[model samples]
Target chain A: MVSLELKRVVVTGLGAITPLGNNVSQYWQNLLQGCSGVGPITLFDASQHNCQIAAEVKGFDPSDYLERKEAKRMDRFAQFAVCASLQAIADAGLEINEFNAERIGAIIGTGIGGLKVLEDQQEVYLTRGSDRVSPFFIPMMIGNMAAGLTAIHTGARGPNSCTVTACAAGANAVGEAFRLIRHGYAEAMICGGTEATITPLCVAGFAAARALSTRNHEPTRASRPFASDRDGFVMGEGAGILVLEELEHAQRRQAHVYAEIVGYGMTCDAYHMTTPIPGGKGATRAMELALKDAGLFPNQVSYINAHGTSTLANDVAETLAVKQALGIHAEKVAISATKSMTGHLLGGSGGIEAIATAMAVATDRIPPTINLEDPDPACDLDYVPQLCRRQQVDVALSNSFGFGGHNVTLAFKKLKG
Target chain B: MNKQEVLEKVKTIVAEQLGVAPERVTPEANFANDLGADSLDTVELVMAMEEAFKVEIPDDEAEKIVMVQQAVDYISQVAN
Candidate 1:
């Protein structure tokens, strides 16, 4: 008598539209080259503002991805989401027309959805009166449209939902997708996050709260994660999507398996709305939990994709959490903060970073964390600084923490076949 | 714009705004029923039509102007 094991889940596809690059390959190349996508804000006039730069998605023409009329109906955030999802679907070599539509699902997360649309409509309301607003306001401005539109576009009739956990939303969405496929709830899931909140109102709000970097004079050097001279995180806008499939299903289809998603851990700080816990207790526990769930020791993980938002408090707290979780092995892990190059993508950060981790394990190349000239005493980890390094990373982990103290950690391992 | 011109303009605006065929934006077609417009879309459509026709549509009148014909008549009265 043979007992069946629970089906494993692996990353079959990856897609991203980021400030660093519009596609995953370009993004990965930019990360290896240590290119800083952070620059002067060009989407709107930031001359009169204190926070004048952002990691804006440069030269994105939605017409390349969406239909003429469909483009008009969706906000930029949703457009990014759908476009990234399209790329992922194509990358996986999965044909929606050929598959059972009822078994496919979509789970997209967004931190601040459709802010551009909302703000624009608000201006029309104030100047031209409320009656002058567009008819697509609600659909274009809502956070859930990213997931909803993906389902509509792909004919996915299975479970469809979204997470709104700020920066952690992307990780949560992917982690939840893993469960959906592992537990026999679904055969495949298209999960990730999208965010295009780099509008004037979003910048102004973050600036008012003193949460964004004020180094407008040096936009490229502004996002210095884990550096002692770090001021604040730079805002960014983009989306990423990953196709997660059951292991057997992927093997049967002869799909390219990037990495196996082994475990996920989530926690809440319950301490502050905008600040992490003093000693990084929540993040530490999250890492520990994820390691335990994967049944692996800290020494097994050779790479880490740190959240490292370039904020003073977050960088220190994240480093502290790594030390607490990995102990003596913390120094051996090759850590890199992709946010150092892409800026803080908010909810979309975790999804894209997860892809980076999987790619690291798949390609045996660890990307670098740029702009770490003056390392902070508080962050003493071996952050693969300034230059990309080639390493045989068998296992990797990625962490994302959000406002309201939400924390998420994901673990990935190279396929052992 | 005359009544006929106003109707034609309203139909074109509604067709473009709602993403439907211009011929489908008839006087009797309901915004939600035939045009596939959700509630938020109706508001935006009114705004676009008002901008295109150079007229201000009152909320009270806007609420009653769901059909293309109703929008044309309302714009005709206000624009002139």
Candidate 2:
């Protein structure tokens, strides 16, 4: 094996257009307060669908962030990506001039890219003839358009790409960006995920698959991760982006470092497409690899951001994985599933949850998993349910598992002088 | 349609498509240089004008109609 010396990477900025809030501060506050963001499906007419509620990002006007003409041409997903990225770039206080433009990069991921746009355009073509379809349909519907548009908006001419690994896409994007900077590919990267898939077709598809919660009467209490009565995940839509820079580069600029990314672990189960391995063997291995990559023991970890989708299968599997990966220390770690509040952001979940994890490490406060009442016996770990906790977290791990058996774990630690 | 009527409609289309004030869209305003329209915006504007006027504008002809006055003149001629 070739020995590789990696550079330290730190998160300097965070931006989010989440179901919880439109910005990072608002999202963090709502997560800590145990507020649920799920509500009635108002984006479109969901009367015919079995699942009628979702965690939709409300009051997001693309014109507020982009030119009206520009906003009209891009899909909602791309709009969210550009808006969040611009916020992150501004938060970092790093100017991208001609000198440093080539050193900056962007990697934004999405699970289902522009599903609303595609569905709408297809309907237009079928009903109004092919010529009636808008010229911007292709650009609006492609998944990579988010990354492409973000580069156009920010003038980052360096490496640009998109990761499309279903739910794991966001974490994979951040992890890949960390590798890019760690291995000396780029000095700084604007990386995360964006998804606006709360459309008619998406809701219908998930509902048909029985993958969504049908608790329309009580939307706020629909997402109950780690609870015995949990049924399924509630679909959510939003974007989360972070500006990651090399430690030395951030130090030189006196950037406010939120947390240091010490490790990234990615693996594939190759067992099933939609369902995770029976006992989360792949997930357990990913966490172990992340711990090893950080050169830290499992006992060193203080908190965990779980991939708890409020689904019975996912919660039990994730619980088993944590126990197997951390051994006895799993019970000691304070784990929280912000998805309980934000709902399942799908591709965008990992990105926002990673930001939450970093903030927990930096602020020494862990957000709670809302609606986790009467926790299942299988999920016996400290889930930090119903209330936030104040603890000095030395290291925190965020986990993301996608539909295609893709498992990713990202490790963040409090910056030590 | 008369020249004045065509000019009024063209101005309205330009103002609506570009998200600009109606008063700002003068006959002399250029779609790109003055109205802040990129290449894609120009195409969309042409498409909108075609739909509004019920006229088929060829690509070469569309390229020639840059100014608001030029669009008004072209539409007036074709409409008559």
Candidate 3:
């Protein structure tokens, strides 16, 4: 029997290509300054569409990180994954050569991978002919191609998989990678989420479902989590990646540890396809499970990076969930929804938010929930409204809920001497 | 179409599919060795040729047309 001794996992590196900025530092700074990244939709001609706003990652050229031939073969989501993974690998400074390549792995999750290519190919098949479709269409549009392409680019050949758990995909990916290292399957893992689905079909579908915010004129203040006049979530595109190294591996290499990952808990509501459970029952249990997994008390959780997607239903329900999970201590926890600035990256949101949570644990300065000028009466907790605060945070939790009733909570603790 | 026209069109297709420059797509250049095209690119290149010239270069024929000149010649012959 293989001994499954749990090893401590630490976040050694972080990378992000978000709507706020292309790198982690810039994204962090913008989040701290309460800057909104939402803007007019320019990826396509959205004039005919109802929702004409999104949080698109601006000025990201694939040539900066990928070779021309390599870039041409990948879908936009895969490109984002590869770029962010490479960035994370570089930031970790842990070399991946012939010797150490077999010990490292990657898991990149995406909500909808290659939707743009699928839509484009369908058009080509209709307008042109079926045989005229490019041979790369199938491979380009698959969700797992992100992890597949990342491995080919970086030469990390351990275990790899892609999680498609909608909004919880990123957090799920990090959790799975943590398990892989904890169980001694691999030494380290590159994990996170990437999503580039601000295309016409995705936008049209979300708009039809009434899941997207229609505040075109006021795109900046549209995503108001825990606010009274809040609307639906604004579609955002980008990727966030983190390097999870075993404690011994990270310490031996003298890695700059951001924070120690203590616990990961996930549960499914099993109730709806597009809506979360009423009163946040599943989400509440997810938080409790994470606390139990980490062997920590509710009072120890000083901050929470709420999944708060700024939707009417999600805000109220998540508020109820947090209150239920933390009991009386929920009122004291400083919770902030970074989605107010980054505008919900869907699957990619968890990755960037995890980075945010780890940063909060490492630095003790939490990013604010911007655009929360009017807090909802039901949400009476301190949202760290509109301003970054300096506080001594010992433990942090990142909560992510997906469309498929998936709820994930990741606990990060400030590494002490 | 004549061989020169076929060559020019093939050069454009190769440049677009293989992500290479038109100037580098000489008649003697091999698709895999010179242009760094794997099996997937070759398949797509053949599909593009079929679409552009309205000629079905079968799988067996595609395997033989590994060089730029072979593709241009094959298309010129098939089209003409």
| Residues A315-353, model 1: lDDT tens digits | 999999999999999989999998889999898887788
TM-score for each model: 0.91, 0.96, 0.97
List model 3 lDDT by residue over A177-262, tens digit each: 98888888888999999999999999999999898889999999988899998879999989999999999999999999999998
- Cα lDDT of candidate 2 equals 0.92
lDDT of 1 by residue, B1-80 (tens): 79888888878888887778898988899998888887777877877786788787877888987777788778888788
Better of 1 and 3 by lDDT: 3
- Considering only chain B, report the TM-score of each candidate against the true chain B: 0.92, 0.95, 0.97
**TM value for model 3:** 0.97
What's the residue-level lDDT of A270 in candidate 2? 94
Candidate 1 reaches a DockQ of: 0.48
Q: What DockQ do you compute for every candidate structure?
A: 0.48, 0.55, 0.76
Clashing pairs in 1: A132-B47, A133-B44, A134-B44, A135-B41, A135-B44
lDDT, candidate 3, B1-80, per-residue tens: 78888899999999998898899999999999999999889999999889899899988998999899999888888788
What shift in Å separates residue A91 of candidate 1 from its native position after superposition?
0.5
Higher-scoring candidate on DockQ, 1 or 2: 2
